[model samples]
Target: MNAPAPIRLLIADDHPVVRDGLSGMFAADPAFEVVGEAADGAEAVRLAGSLEPDVVLMDLRMPGMDGVAAITELARTGSPARVLVLTTYDSDSYVLPAIAAGATGYLLKDAPRDELLRAVRAAANHEAVLAPSVAARLMDRVRPPAPALLTPREHEVLTWVAAGATNREAAARLLISEATVKTHLLNIYAKLGANDRASAVAAAFTRGILTPGTGA
Candidate 1:
């Protein structure tokens, strides 16, 4: 039986040191072959077309075309190379776009050598690979935010406010100090992300925290 051929790789980054380091790292391993290096997204796109590597280790913040654009172009042109995003940023601002742009995997620059190698291998095999942090960030980006929590007192205060009661009246009705009513209103404003009583009432109604024709 013959051994499988090495996975061809293209390293694309704006930093010379990163490219050099990656090249050296992969060169040390027999499982991978570093075919070419590109300093920017445009060059990456160009080199990817010519090299026809199995995988492209892309950096997101490169000048000119950027990694996302390169990934987009590669996909648009139907390049067979898989894109493995290797960058320092794991924020939603960075991770979401690259994935949306057609990255096969996302690994942070700080990933361990073994993990990165495995990720590259996975990418070469057309498997999805995501750093733990990147995966978490992606999940958070896709998952809906938790609904706002409101205390019973805050709900009551909002209900009274929504019923068109003045603060003094609400205080008298709730048998609480006007100052206490004001405090609850502030908390409601913050929880509901409302600028004022009217907006707070509106937000409460919108969120189903308050029902129409209901009062405290």
Candidate 2:
């Protein structure tokens, strides 16, 4: 049986030291072959087109045209090389846009050598890879925001409404004026984003602001 061909790579970073370090690391490993290097996004794009590497290890903040633009250009021009963003930035501002621009993976510069190697392998196979913090940030971005909290008084009014109590009945039971009950209900409606008594009760239950058998 024959061994698999080494995964070809292009390192793209503005800093010469970073490029040299990455090149040396990959060169030391038989699984990867460092084919070329670029100092900026535009050069990265040009080198990517010429080198025909299996993966491009990209840095986000280069001198011109940045990593996102390089990735975008590669995808736009239908390049077969997958991009693995190797950067120090894990913020949403950096991670989201890079992924959106067609990066195969996002790994922080602080990642361990084994982790980065695994990420590059994964990227070569066109799989998604993200640093732990970057994955958490992405999850937070995609997950829906929690519903606004309701005040205790609003909760009480909603509880009563859920229990099928009329505003007048609820007010009499609570020893408050009917108008006061109405005001509370109005506030409850606004808080729960409901238009009327029935909707308010339903919304409250759905949002866990009110539970069955709860009282005002």
Candidate 3:
């Protein structure tokens, strides 16, 4: 029997040390083949188009076009590569936008070697992966019932949010247009003091408005 093909990877970050380190790590993994590297987000987008790696490990705070911006372009440009974000900050401010822009996973740079490898493999396969704590934190945002600001309809929307519904999915569930869903979300943000989807959910949690339940 022969070994299976390694997952192709592209590492993009501003730090040379981090890029080199990641390349070495991937090389050590028999299942990963690091095919390209980029020193900035703009270069990352460029290399992604050229190398067409299976997964791109992108740094968030790059000099140009940042990770979220680059991921958005990747999605818009119809790139086949999957994005897995690596950032120093685990805050919702960055994570939520990255997800919206089409990153399939998120991880902090301090993540363990095993987990990082696993995340890359999962991203290559189009699966969402995150630190367990990050996932739990995101879940908190999806269903926070805070400040009693949501009307029944807003609450309905929030429930879909809690269920991880994108605006399109939420709109479909509510039998409304996607534009209307965006309108409702804007209002929800105003009422909830939320600047983004993650913050809105977090506000709900802080206000004791949403609680997760295990099916009994």
In model 3, the Cα lDDT at residue 125 comes to: 85
Candidate 2 vs candidate 3: the lDDT winner is 2
Span of 10 residues, lowest total lDDT, candidate 1: 146-155
Q: Which scores better on TM-score, 1 or 3?
A: 1
Runs in model 1 lying further than 4 Å from the true structure? 151-216
TM-scores of all candidate predictions against the true structure: 0.72, 0.71, 0.66
Whole-model lDDT values for every prediction: 0.92, 0.91, 0.87
lDDT per residue as tens, model 3, 39-144: 8888988999999899999999988778888999999999999999988988889888998899999999899998899899899888999877679779999976
> How big is the RMSD of model 3?
15.3
Mark the regions of model 3 whose C-alpha exceeds 4 Å error after superposition. 144-216
Clashing pairs in 1: none
Residue 136 CA displacement from its true place in model 1, Å: 1.1
For the record, the alpha-carbon RMSD of candidate 2 to the native fold, in angstroms, is 8.9
Tell me each candidate's RMSD, in Å, in order. 8.7, 8.9, 15.3
- The 10-residue segment of model 3 with minimum total lDDT is 207-216
Candidate 3 overall lDDT versus native: 0.87
